[model samples]
Target chain A: MQPYPITAMALCNGMGDSTAAVLAALRAGRSGLGPCPAEFELDAVVGAVPGPLPPLPGSLERVRDTRQTRIAAVALAELQAPLARACARWGADRVGVVLGTSTGGIEASEGAYAHAHAHGGALPSHYDVERSHALDAVLHLARVFGGGLAGPAYVVSTACSSSAKVFASAQRLLAAGLCDAVLVGGVDSLCRLTVRGFAGLEVLSSAPCRPFSRERAGINIGEGAALLLVERTGEGPARLLGVGESSDAYHMTSPHPEGLGARLAMERALQLAGLVAADVDHVNAHGTGTRQNDSMESQAIRAVFAGAPAPAVVATKGYTGHMLGAAGATEVAFVVDAIAGGYLPASVGADPLDEALGVDVVTARREQRTRAALSNSFAFGGSNCSVLVGGPA
Target chain B: MSAPGFSVRGLGFWAPGYPDLAAWQARPDACPEDQSATPKAELLPPMMRRRTSLLTRMAAEVAAQALRAGGLDPTGATLVYGSVYGEIRTTLDLLAALLVAGEPLSPTKFHNSVHNTAAGYVSIATGSRAGNAALSAGRSTLAMGLLECAALVAAGEGDVVLVIAEEPLPEPLAAGRRWGPFAAAFALAAPASSDMPATTCRLEQGPNDKSLAPARPAPAWLADNPCAAALALVDALAAGAPARVALEPHLAAGWHCGLGAGA
Candidate 1:
């Protein structure tokens, strides 16, 4: 798999609403997590984009207006000019959009359902699940927005690994010649369904997350979006070098204790990149902060690197909270910044790293020249995807 | 833009009346009005079985049948699941619990609410370490799923199982849905090693060749089912005849599928 150039990208998380702001936050070693919103009864930390996201451009109201879409709109707005230029350079049909999402406006249903329950199961006349809860709503929004891209479009919804896997899918489409350029993204917004769901799972931490720490408690869920435009053309920050994926076949909600699936995903990613374990310069760990997840991920990293001074590992979830489906693509943005900008963001909240885990989880930001980095995203259902991004060929 | 095609190794279909290929072929267009009986996911052990939702159960049933029918190792193939309204019943259940006062959300239901739940259960049941994906393209689900399956096989991801399903929406949420409950699975492999005669499938750019997608075998004008588009191709596979199948439910997606000898 030859490297594909990432031409343009846009993303917003609790850390910041733009990539520049996010990078600035990373460079400053700031955390975006805060006390959970009062509206939600859950007692936990969260990473929510600041209030009042721009609404969908008017005409799309009937079929694609959603809080998730509004979150996506922020990213889409940032790329409008470049995206439109790509559409012009390559015919609209020659561009494709593939998004990854877990909570697709399910909040739309939450509000509607609340109204329905109060009114004896009668949903408001204005409610439209097809438009709002369409799990692929963000895909449609991307397709229609930014001057209308009419191409092969779809969505991947494999929990946290969803967006990371998009690189591979987009690569396939490009290699198979379905589209010349592809807009790959991940979109998910704060919703009671996700917050309450994590609470129900008993994996919600009342305090900020501490990845790979001895006192690690659980996850602080977040909402965010990341969009990257890839082309056969050059002149971008990084290249998507390789992608690898695997299933744990172990449990529904738990990862394999040995992290065999996670290890396979990393090794396979290296194999696809025409490199070995030694070629990896940095690692952006999933590091969900849950006891089981952090412990198992460390084991997997230790297994792969297998030497003193493994790759510099930073768990960004400590900063962004577990953004669910959007974590993968958003992390790739950080990896790209690490490679091109020559910096490694610290694993915020992981001050006293868990030495027993045996993987060096970096706790301080540093200026370092990184050539290639592997971003790991593992999800419930034991789904794992590892993506490698390189500085230049 | 026509894709390099693959071979169909086996097929699986399930619905209220038609539970298997044999049943489907017996009455190729039998969309039974009485939607009563459900798919029994026998491959899942009781413990795993008890935790699954109807949508997951339906997906497991068809995926197992296809893998077994193809004479391929059930755990050996990569999986691609395409569904618009995935794990809907589980989502509804979670929402109901969350909306109720004083009732805590169910952990099991929350775990089951992920769109990839079905793909995960199937892979876990078969003990497969291969990668699996759950995706959707709205009305173009089956077509997009086929594209993914073809790409995985082409990329040497291994043999592939492409499953398209959508469970019937219950009550208040029904208005947003246009499809009925059904599931379909197609087991696929890379083309022959040499120039040997075999059934093939190629997705091309054009208006669909509607001649191949026969009217679905349903009692009345039933709503479209996610799996409904594959009926014609399944029949052609059963009879070893050449046919061009329309993978998209609607005709205007600008993609065409050919399935049969040299198709």
Candidate 2:
């Protein structure tokens, strides 16, 4: 199996004003979630970063929507230095950009729609296809990094697993010799539409989410962005060991009762890596804290590991909430950090493991060396993806 | 990169105004107002038909047609549904419900609003207990779906794979008169015999300087070209030789697909 190299750094917003904040959050096992004000009509808990998110520069604001574009812009800014250095080292024209996002600029469009209905005018001339759809984030980021000159720019919006699939796409592109370096990540922000949409699904938990716990409820919606720089070079920060993607083709909203798709995805990833289940040091489960999802994933883990000692399991939704399409990429950043730091952060709200679940849940932070970790991202419509990441061999 | 091409075992389509390829090619008069045809309802069951968006109904109908055309059952067939803007009308409705009624949105509508909703609905309707995938690539929706279909077949996951591409009516705000609504489908399987025609499609870096050796314009450029380009390929294969069809470049990459008769 060919290995895809991770040649640069990963960045997020809540990791402490900077990359150090992310390190601090990991070391202290702190969650970035906080209460969202009533203005957003959101009563459930949110994993929102504290502080004012300044609007995008007027130049960029002229062409795009606000809410998500701001988050995408900030995420790009956070990784600018590392990305620029990587580009300089690998040639700017060799790098491509791919982003995973569900709600590209919908929040802004919703506002524009309301304005058009009330004022009876055009939808702010800037609401073009490049600005309103999911691809806008990718295009905007490409322009920011001068990668439009390099290769194609794409955005994947396969629900929650959107970003995780970007890693798979990047790997395939590299394997196909499409590009030498790629920017793969996901970004999503709090929007009334997403919040209300999930709320309508009756899966939003008012209290903090408890993943893998018998008493756990539903998930808390969060908003953030994460980006990883990838290249084909052998030497780098980490390597993408393998990626597995599958669609359950089961129910639209519900997972398979036996977690067939989840099991297939994990097994495929393991097979692609030529590693057994025991080789996986830790698993970042797609434990959304929802009743069906948590149980389904647990069943899949047990089916894969069987009688062997299950890998240490950690759920980051307690910290970052569920970022939907962005959840996969954001969680992968945590997995990369776990390998770099040699420890598994506790699942913040997970207390007692559900007796029905057959795997060990890491409730409290533990220090242990991990060579590799598997990150899982499951979406609505039964889209499932698992990515395996490991340290330098 | 030299993976063997899949066999084109069968083909099908469901489109506005036209229920089958014959009816579609007849070029019936367009609707006076929106020029959109009333979707054919007879293709799906009543229970599975309720509240389905134009995209879902079109995708399922086309997918089923492909399976039937191939003389294969929908059961256990791997599905790959590709679309650019998925169920836009339903998405608009959800947003409207949030703003006006402040009413809790319907879970059904919310689920269908996702890009992969059509793939899931097809699975449920066909009772397909196998792999399902939904992908989106501007202009390359069909190509992407075909790529995955070929890969899955190559990986030995299925005997045949169904690749379906459908685009919902462009809302006034979204499409701005750019492209119209259409759905196309093809059933691909591992080559059964060496004599069958073979085709290889790939996404390549753009601006090829090579002179056009009888290059065909993208399907979108062909006037009144709905469901015809797919049929054209079928015709081209029957009159076997080598032919290349250039799809509109997506993501700034030049993409040209080659189809040829093979031994």
Candidate 3:
């Protein structure tokens, strides 16, 4: 497959709202984990976006005005200029939108549930189920930028791997001459269902998450959105070289014991890029900080790049918590920023790396000119996606 | 907007009236639709059969029908599942548990509630290792799935098994909406394949006003449920002619899928 250019990107996560702010925090190895502030009954730390989301403009007044859509609106606003430029470069009909999400406007539904419970099971009039549909984010973006996109607009919702898989579909669309450019990203907002659900499963860490550490506990749920404009003929700072996807087919929740699916996805990604494991300079792992996830990911990494100098293994979840469906694209944006700035962000929370894993876990910021990087996102239901990004060779 | 290198080789559908392609072709003008009862699918293993929801079963049944029609191996075909509303029953169950009892969601419900639950179950049942994608785009779902599947086949990825489905929302959540459950599947293959069905088709984006509507007055379910729009495509295919379906109210153009004379 041919590489596609990443022309522009916008991010809003726990560490910061802009690329500059997030890069600064990363270079300083700052942890964005803080006390749980969303009033969930579960006791756990989280990486929530600070401050209120910027209000949606009047143009999008008809769309559902939920927290998730508002967060997506912020990212969409940032990409407006470049998106418009792309629309001019290629007619609006040639530009598409592909977004990923797990729980879309679910918090709105939860709020409605709360209201209904308080009033003897009578729901509020404004509580429409379509507002909470998983496709809300896509509709919100489409409604916001009504005439700018007229191709392949949809939402991919495969739990956490949702966004990363968007790259695969985008590549196919471009390679098959379906669309000239695409607006691809992911958005997920905090909701009681996810937080409480993870807590019941005993995977929500009460303390800050620590990936790849001997004492690593579990994940910290977070919320945010990440958007990028990918085109076939743009002079962008980074390129999506290849994407590999696979399903675990083992357990619905727990990953394959041997990380079989994860390993296959990485190997397939490297193969598609026509590069050896040694060509990768950095690894952005889906280290959810859970004991099972960290352990399985470590084994998978070791197996994929066996006998080669290991890439700088780092996990950004500690800085932004796990953004669920949005994690893949958010982490990809974070890695692209690191590559452009010529530094490798450290894995902030993991200390005293687990000796059993045999992986080089980055613990401190390092100044290195990274040429190619790999990002992994493994979701529930055993879905795994790996994306390779790099600058011009 | 031309899908120059792709073709739709097979099609399958399931709903209140239609059970599969053969049954539908046998009686296209049956009134009030078939309303035949959907039997328990024996294709899946016991565990999966038990775990599978009615919605998932509808999708898988149609997918199997298409795959059989195309004579393609499930393991070699990429799966793309599209939906308007996904697993509404499970979603309502989970929400009720959370709001009424303040209890954690059951692991089964949690897994089943994901949009890709049907894709997961299909892969497990057939042992498919190929890539899979599950997506949603409201009423344009079937059109979007057709576009995506065409792209995949045009890229020479592999044969694609595309499934689109929707079930009615819980009465409270549904309010006055009258849509019911429906699912459709298609086996889309690249041009000139030996196993290809007679209906070799390609999709192109064309004038918006050229968009198609149901030939007859649509049933309440067909009018409201997005996935049911797939029946329009089936209707056109059964007529052995070229047709287009409007993805409007969303996109600027409708999809024009044409079948070759062999169809």
Candidate 4:
């Protein structure tokens, strides 16, 4: 596949509400995990977007309000200029919007259910499920960007790998000549459903997550948004070289013990990019710190880079927790920054590396220029996507 | 604009009155008073079947049927699952446990709540490690999914199993959105080598002209769920004739689909 240039990116995750803040926090190896909000009875910590959020613009007032859309609005706000520029270059109709979200406004459903359970009556007026459908972000973003109403606008939802797969879908749309530019990324905000869901799975860590570390317990559910404007235009700061996806068909929750799907995704991504493990200088692993995920991902990474100089492995989940559907795009932002900034953000929570894992999990920041980097995002249901982004060679 | 299309090697469907492609084709005008009982998906191993939701079951059932009908290896094709809303019942179940019962969610139910649950189960059932994508574009989900399927085959990525499924949303949540429970699957291959003579599909980009539409009238459920649009395409494929569906108003550009005699 021909590489597509990424002209602009905007991200607002738990690590920071702005790109500059996120990059600084990454450089400083800071952990954003904090005590779970008092409202939730969970004992675990979480990575939440701090402070109040901005209200939706008057133009988007018609759209419903949910933590998910509000967070997406914040992220899209950062890309207003870039998005407008892209729409100008390629008429608004030529620009498509592809978003990923596992729980789109589930919190709204929770609130509606809570109200009905208490009052025992008709649901509230604003409690329309269709409005908060998982594809709402696509609609909201499209409306904000002016015109994707009748274009190739859709939502890719495959749990955690949702957003990463959006890149592949966007690339296909471009290769097939469906669109000239794509606003692609993901958004998932904190919701009781996701929080309690992870807790029920018993994978919610009581403290900050420790990815690829010996003492790692599980994950801290988090939320935010990451949006990138990709175009078939000239070379930019970063480019999406390739995207590969696979399914383990192994388990609904647990991944394949040998990480067969993960390995296949990485190999496929490398094959698509016309590169190999040797060409990769850094790896942003999908390390959620769960025993099964870390163990299997380590094995997969070792297999993909075997007999070659393996790239420095960095897991940013320690800094931002596991953002679920949004993690793919949010983490890719860091990979783009790593390629441009010429530094590897340390896997902050990984202190004593799990020697048994046999993978070089970076625990300290490294200042080195890298041309190619791979980002891994493996989701429940054995869905896996690996995206390669790097500086122009 | 429309690009060259793929051939419909095989087709599987589950609707109110139709249990399979042949059954549906047998009576194109039939519409059951109520949705049929969800299939048990005996094809799935007992363990896998136990873990699947009704939505996942419908998806797997149709996918397997398509592969079997086409004489294609399930392991060799990529799976593209499309839906407007995913696992709404499971989501409501988890929410009920949390908000109404004030109890922890059942781990099994929680795991099944993701949108890609069907895709995951489909891969596991087929023992396929091939790439799979789950997409939703609201009312145009089926149109967008077909576009994706056509692109994969055109790019020589691999044969594809395109499945579009949408079950009705639960009550209260279902009050405003009135979607019918339906599932449709297609075994698609690059038109250059498909064996289905009467069901080859060619895609080309064109104007968003409402003047060109499927000859068959859309079912009543088309208003509720977007994937019902497949019924029109299925009608043409079943009749073994030529048809063009204007995919505009749903897709970026208008898509002209031609069902023709195979070479």
- What DockQ does each listed candidate score? 0.74, 0.37, 0.58, 0.71
| Candidate 3 residue runs with Cα over 4 Å from true position | A39-42, A58-62, A117-122, A132-134, A142-147, B27-39, B100-102, B208-217, B245-252, B261-263
The lDDT, on a scale of 0 to 1, for candidate 3 is: 0.78
Candidate 1 docking category? medium
Which runs in model 2 stand beyond 4 Å of their true positions? A13-18, A37-39, A57-63, A81-94, A134-137, B1-9, B22-45, B67-78, B129-131, B140-172, B175-179, B188-241, B249-253, B261-263
What is candidate 2's lDDT per residue for A48-70, written digit by digit as tens? 65556656666553246466766
Q: Per-residue alpha-carbon lDDT of model 3 for A1-393, expressed as tens digits?
A: 899999999888787776566667877888777876655554668877776777655455446677788778777777878888888889887998888998787777777767776786666776677754446445556535634577778888898999999888888888888889988889998877787778767788888888988888899998888888899897887899999988877777888878888998998888888988998989999999998998899889999989778888989998999999899999899888888888888898788888788889988888988888989998876789999999854
Clashing pairs in 3: B17-B34
Q: What is the DockQ of candidate 4?
A: 0.71
Worst 10 residues of 4 chain B by lDDT: B246-255
**Candidate 4: regions farther than 4 A off:** A39-42, A58-62, A146-150, B33-36, B100-102, B196-198, B204-210, B221-223, B248-256, B261-263
TM-score of every candidate: 0.96, 0.87, 0.94, 0.95
Candidate 1 lDDT over residue span A271-372, tens digit each = 988988888889999999998988888889889998635889989988889999899999998888888779898899887878898887789988888888
Q: Which pairs in model 2 have colliding backbones? A: A15-A21, A15-A22, A16-A21
Displacement of residue A159 (Cα, Å) in model 4 is 0.2
User: lDDT per model, in order?
Assistant: 0.82, 0.69, 0.78, 0.80
**Best candidate, DockQ-wise?**
1
lDDT accuracy of residue B32 in candidate 2? 25
Residue B133 of model 4, lDDT score: 86
Q: Where is model 2 chain A poorest over a 10-residue stretch in terms of lDDT? A: A145-154
- Candidate 4 residue-wise lDDT, A231-327, digit = tens: 9876568999999889898888899999999999999999988998999988899999999999999999999999889778999999888999899
- Could you give the DockQ of candidate 1? 0.74
